[model samples]
Target: MGALMSVAPEPGWPEPEWHRPPVGGYTADDLDRLPNLPPHTELIDGSLILVSPQTAFHMRAMRLLENRLLEAAPPELDVAREMTVTLGPRDRPEPDVLVVKGEAEPRQTTFQPEDVILAIEVVSAESEARDRNVKPRKYAEAGIRHFWRVEEDKGLPVVYVFELEPATKTYVVSGIYHEQLKVPVPFPIKIDLTAINRRQP
Candidate 1:
């Protein structure tokens, strides 16, 4: 007698009868199983999205910003990289950089925008749209008080600082830093736009 072959079920488990191709989505589990991703990819809207690769100048500016921010960071502040923030099932995004007030381990949940003191995104050609539109709304909806978009491609970061406007339920631009401007954060640090410009690729 011939052995019976077992057939695998279709991709979508619960609704096997519902015929539809998986419309590309990822769960937190999917993100966990991925092997190390290159720095240029970020997880957004439950899928891995490719961002523009950083250039030498971009890296230099990032390093400078990191150094300045780190030096003046409050003891309560925790600076991190490519960390995921759960913004509903369709809106989880891994920001390039974040400043938060508490440890991540014990919490186990991704950073809530309210938990984050600030969010900074370094925009390259590929990431310009999301950095400008999607992320700002995601952070704002999550109640993040401040956000910064750093445009490295322009040879200088056009910093956009947004603060939540309670009455309006939206973030209002508090400051825009093009050249030399002091950030309104409690701890003071000078972001040298000239230095950022000098390092542009």
Candidate 2:
């Protein structure tokens, strides 16, 4: 009988190297192990973030703000709060308030910069830095139409309003409102910031 010949397998296949996966990619197990998160915590860019819980004062301010805008907004316009804004696959934020120029939906929906006419962040002692630096830059990069930062330290609803000018990759701080009532909002409608500022938190 002729000797049986064994064919060897091809030799050019890539070798498998066992390396730890990048931290940027988190598995379900990793997510599950995350500490118990407060209501304000949100996942952004695959990192866990702890946001300050909205105080009663904050809620009051937000509601009053929304109501005023609603009154001046076109029947088709929509205003929302604490809703998720997804900037990219890795970035999702829930701003204190968001104003949209479109038909009203029955419920709040996740939004993108394109869906937002304005994004508002309320700054408490803790969140001031993130709101000023992290969010503003992200909103600018995402091409948000406008952004507002309301600081609690001010006597009234002291806010900084910025309009996105993509040509410069930065926001044009169009106006600063010390007295809520005195601010001239550029949108085709008016909102009562004073009313919002008075809400009991």
Candidate 3:
């Protein structure tokens, strides 16, 4: 039998090494290769950014909002949750809830910006900045007509709606609703926020 020999650990062993890909180089296809991604992970400007985890309250509010949006959306539109919307070669954001122009095909990997009519983001403490500022700017520039941001005020959801100004590619405040979300753009619809909050209990 040969004498036993011990191998020394390499320098920086046990320390995970990170390779930084060039900015604006990553595409949606690259994002698809990664598996077991966290629920809120997103690709922004070719950077893989892991979003904050959703609190129970945030998820409950998101589900309630989705249900309301679905009930109000037109027959031609479909409301989905946490589906990636491809904004560009380097931008793929997964909105908390979104309304698309038509039924989603089974093999669809991502929704195109033109196909997304409305994008909604529910604010968590950790996601406030991106949800309120970053996403709105990107979604508007991508020509998504409507955007909604849901914020918790006194443990209740308050929704702020915005509509895109096409010429400027910017969003203008459409309405802000606390007890109810009522709007006519895309279609006429009313969501009773009070009722939704009651269901949380």
Query: lDDT tens digits, residues 32-146, model 3?
Result: 7755444555776776666554577687788788888887888999998988998988888889898999999998768999999889888877666778888899999999999
Instruction: Report the lDDT tens digits of candidate 1 across residue range 25-94.
Output: 6554444445544343445565556444457655665666666677678888877766777666655576
The TM-score between candidate 3 and the true structure equals: 0.85
Cα lDDT, all candidates: 0.64, 0.63, 0.78
Tens digit of per-residue lDDT, candidate 2, span 15-131: 322122246743323323444433444445555455544565566656766777666666656788777677776566678888876754565346757878888887766666668
Winning candidate number (lDDT):
3
Q: Clashing residue pairs in candidate 1, if any?
A: none
Residue 94 lDDT (model 2): 74
- Stretches off by above 4 angstroms in model 3 are 1-25, 198-201
Q: Pick the candidate with the highest TM-score.
A: 3
What are the runs in model 2 whose C-alpha is more than 4 Å off?
A: 1-22, 25-40, 101-109, 181-186, 189-192, 197-201
Candidate 1 — number of clashing residue pairs?
Answer: 0
